[model samples]
Target: MTWRWLLLLISLTACQGPDQGDPYRPYLRVADKDDVPTLDPARGYDTASWQFEDLIFETLVDYNDEGQIIGELAQQWKAEANGTRFVFRLRDDAMFSHGRQVTAEDVRFAITRVLAPETGSPGRDFFLSVRGARTCDKPGCEVAGLVTLDNKTLVVEVEQPDPLFLHKMALPFASAVPPEIIVREGENFDFRPVGTGPFLLAERVAGQRLVLKPNPYYRGAVQPRLPGIVRFVGVPEDLAWMRYRAGLLDLAIIPPAEIPIVLRDPKLSRLLRTADTLRTQYVGLNCARPPFTDVRVRQAMNYAIDRRKLIAILHHRASPPQGIVPPTMPGYPQRPEPYPFDPPRALKLLQAAGLGGGFQATLWLRNDETAIRVAQSLQQDWERVGVRVRLKPVAWGPFLDAVRHNPNIDMFLLGWEADFPDPSNFLEVLFHSRQIGANNHTYYSNPVVDALLEQAASTTEPAQRTELYLLAEQRILDDAPWVLLYHPRTMLLSSDRLRGLRLHAWRPPRLAQLWFAEEKTEE
Candidate 1:
């Protein structure tokens, strides 16, 4: 019995040592933001949760740094029956961290679990195109679209032709799960996530920290060269910056207030890296309510704010956006000069809409210093046009709830990042009438815009789709459902020794290929 225990311990520690491929770097250290509301992949729609989930889960498809879709778990796939049906071939070599082979059955079960209404996954809308996906109201609710032909082959059939369906599968929500573990653990499974990715969740200290170790059975294009990773959660932004500067942390975001200080110092500035993100921040106006329901009033609000100045103050790392779609995405149209900072025009529009005296409304914001600054700037700008603004700052969870369902919410500060790089993600999900209370928080609806978006989704021709999408965008711009702000740039500070780091707009930095050189003393 003692000899058997010795063998079991040896088997467990076999893959725990430093990788032979890269002998120097043994661990990767990062800051885990406190903003991560949940570690549950299905319920976590924020950037923080997605970043950690990407390390622990393997999606069927994934995107490269250039936004090209590539295979992750599924070795290859074929689009059959005019893009409505897709057949995926899973690699027999792929295995979970628990020493179980990943199969087509696992893929089928994972997707259906997300679509199950009982899970209340915020990402359920992404899978509605799958046949019978809407019927997943309970546990074990069958998804007719998901079919496992064998251990390696799986098929999915959608109701209509969707060219972007493959891209959607690359999202972290499409990660494969082991059915046996899920059935055994039930609702508590996400706390101890099991997947076939480059890393496995070794420890999670509730909301404080999460630790990961490399999985030897991972069969992806990239593998974790580091032996372990530690993500420090609930650390204050300023503390994170201090730790990075003191060499206690390897990577962290440069706090907005500290950017100038870092830029002034040559040594610190050398560590800074920045890239424009695919997210667009905006102030949503309730189109269902009065005062904002009038197109003239909405347009007046759009013209009143000085976006360029606000970008300079609140987000020096951001670029002024002419439209909702960020510049990072393809097919973004060239735009005319933005509405132009003309207060007289805004005043005239307000008078034309019988709101010459303006109206009083509350502006909702999350409990963030940056958001509060932006809100104050807008309040002062709108005052010139006779609109009195009352500011209300709430915690993260309550803020989302109020913004999504509260009828009294006149306006709110929020942002959206594309789950996949396509115009339909913004046009159809954010502004389309069908998503009124769901993704369309503004309650915006236009028959013409809806028709154009629907046509664009179904159209296979690239040129035709672009034309239809652009037309819908123009219509939305004309209606002014939101005061489109700027697209922020994601900035990071890392030790100069960190190599092979690739930042992505939709996902977190790909850390599997990341390695570190020997530390050097600063000049």
Candidate 2:
């Protein structure tokens, strides 16, 4: 058996003890993102970030508590002619939160609008790498391949046949949105979501909280066992701990800063820490631009970092990241060795790049305290090598805008997490020259790297795909566009009563399948 399955089997054995054992509990108050701009799937970034969103609207496919994609809205699915084309057979009983039946047409409309630029959707970045996506971007555009043949059958054609297509369908952007709400309403759809997922939005207060209640109109009784409500409290990770301690919250995702204190309490025995393989924190080099244009300059910077110290800052719980994909992920070429903290080597390389004398470079960072800390560390580290660094700090939202949409820095700090477990999800989207949008601040690309990713995406065979990914991963490690730092670990602190909680591929805190003890409920 593969390592993924092996880990899953061992991890899940604990939750499967006895069916009649514990009753699943309902409400969970948790830390949340800054905002979910709209409920319209096409236009929103964090719209579906909260667990409440997951219940209110679901993708055609969804991850179980373990982070593996299980059929959610698409009860049964099949791809035709050797996985080149896909035909999802929808559950006949599936219906939107509104009384309308969910037809194949709704899925097609939702996906097509994502490729439509004028919708003002950030999800556009997610699909640009999709096959046949170019046609949608043309002046008089049309997304050629998607079709709804009947009420239940949805067929999609791709320019290049990709085996990962079905898995990609399981991502948030591919989640089914109501054709009537997302399309007809546009901006107005944020207040009202028309979906076929597990829950419905009850009420939302800006800058404070967002609440979701179980959708009564949902069909089929096979659903999340805990069915009351999921609320996301928009507060810093520090405050989230206090809420959890006060019994006002059941779970809180431990951010880097909070790991130290969260681990201190003997009360956090239920704390679960897992490799969040999705995001990789690193310093990005603008290969074609500015002071970072020289490869030696990039390498010099690499020699100056201390991954051990970075992990120490994160409280030593997270796996010091080896590469973009962890060793747990398939096709790891090799564990990424830690860069030597050699200021002399860094200085020599800088000299080789004709930058021996100190040159001023901007260290762009978001306004978060953590980002500021990381920036401060690098600022001091490189200063020893005669690289004077000016810190460019901006608030999180505008910070992303400056990094992605417009190029404004010599070196930029960033993080990347996989939407799916696939290597193509890591290599193709960020590194593929084709996908360098406002989101891809790094313009680095190579034809060989692109070819390997294309080969991997073209075939469905896991072995062949793994081989291609391994080769591709090695290429990037050598290229070194970004220094691979430690993999962030997510620590979940909840009561012992919180059973069957799973932090899946995206680190989305799923409240489904959890049970409250009968003993605890009475107390």
Candidate 3:
């Protein structure tokens, strides 16, 4: 037999008891963006923050690999009164990292914190269905929709019937936090989080790195497979890939420029993995501004750009625009192509809008390498039809503020990934007038579209709700507030030694299921 087989045989022979064997593998390594903005679940709106929060926190419900809703903290939930009310039963053995049994009161306090104005949670809008949710700004404000019956049972009531509320519960924003700990630690509790997850935050080095270890009191059915995980940050994307090549990181993200080189290499190509992401990139116009206020000008801009060319140059894995709503989404409408690459037609439309001489405008974008390529491509495409464009690249936070507050910015390039798998999450949240100065950066508003979205949310029947959503999507497409670009596929590079690395479409990868192939399997 081979030496590897001999070692395995000896290990098996040396096993003296059922509780003893080779010790569990100790470490896992991965790469992330420059920094994690925040570890606080309530204020985590960015991807990096959500990634860390997802690993260290547990929500009431979660999505499985096939995108179906599954129970996490709660053992099971029952819907009654035509989906108006939901009753959840906590698992008897659930325990927080501090070794306290998780109770229903903890759930109530966690949600009340999100509702409090002091928390400043961007996800507060998601829970408006609860009675008195709109007016309550402080804890103990008598929310009629929330009630904890005993130590293990809780009830939630909504004003209208909503079948999608369960899906919303699976978001990271709904993850439970230790109420007593927060009360004692105050705002500092955000950085020092405590949750009932498989892993706990063991150490952090400001902007440099973060380390997590298996939770001793974890109550989940599956414990963390590795003893510990180390996440490195602030490393440039190219340099991170180099680290991956040298076996420093088990996982790394492949940048757009290096995709070709990686694919050409025989050894590197075997380790490539790809998944379709539920994300959409677009160039949003300021609908309230002077030139873009005209629908003809908006249509002209969309028609001038060559979308397929952009995809070929920067992203071979991206699919061309079907609509602002990704095609994979339920209830997506089949609509006619309102704008294709027609420079002459674009010129005519601009002339009709009384801009025959063309107009000067600025496009705002982030200062990332990929964003720069996208901005340059758009400039070239628009200049072909007489529109002069200037590119302004800014940092991420300042760019978000400028898009929301600066009225002079003619257009901006950005992208939105779905928080939940629903049509309302995309169509209504982004185009609804109520969201202006928020995610609706375009200031897009149409009374007809508004009514359709509201009706869809209130409707109980799935077929009827789908029709209403389709109508709203069509109306927004006709308005052309955003020149929808493409849906990107997620590409990840990892060491071949790593196994069971599955992707979650709406969130980050789950770390509990991953293990090194060389390690002996857990019982």
User: Residue by residue across 137-245, what tens digits does model 1's lDDT show?
Assistant: 7645678888899999999999999988998888777788888888888777767888788888888786577788888788778878777878776665555665565
Instruction: Please list all clashing residue pairs in model 3, or write none if there are none.
Output: none
> What value does the lDDT take at residue 507 in candidate 1?
71
lDDT of 2 by residue, 48-160 (tens): 35344556666677766566667777887776665556777788888888888888877776777777777655566555544566567422245557767798888776666
- Regions of candidate 1 where Cα sits further than 4 Å from its true position: 1-27, 405-407, 520-523
Candidate 3, RMSD to the unseen true structure: 7.7
Q: Rate residue 90 of model 1 by lDDT.
A: 88
Residue-level error in angstroms, candidate 1, position 309: 0.9
lDDT of each: 0.81, 0.67, 0.80
Best-to-worst order by lDDT is 1, 3, 2
TM-score of each: 0.88, 0.84, 0.88
The TM-score, computed over Cα atoms with residue i paired to residue i, of candidate 2 is 0.84
Q: What lDDT is reached at residue 36 by model 3?
A: 67
Q: Give the lDDT of residue 157 in candidate 3.
A: 91
Cα lDDT tens digits, model 3, 368-423, are 76788888999999998889999998766567668767877899999888888888
Look at candidate 1 and tell me the lDDT of residue 503.
77
What lDDT does candidate 3 reach at residue 326?
79
Judging by TM-score, tell me the better candidate of 1 and 3: 3
Best by TM-score: 3
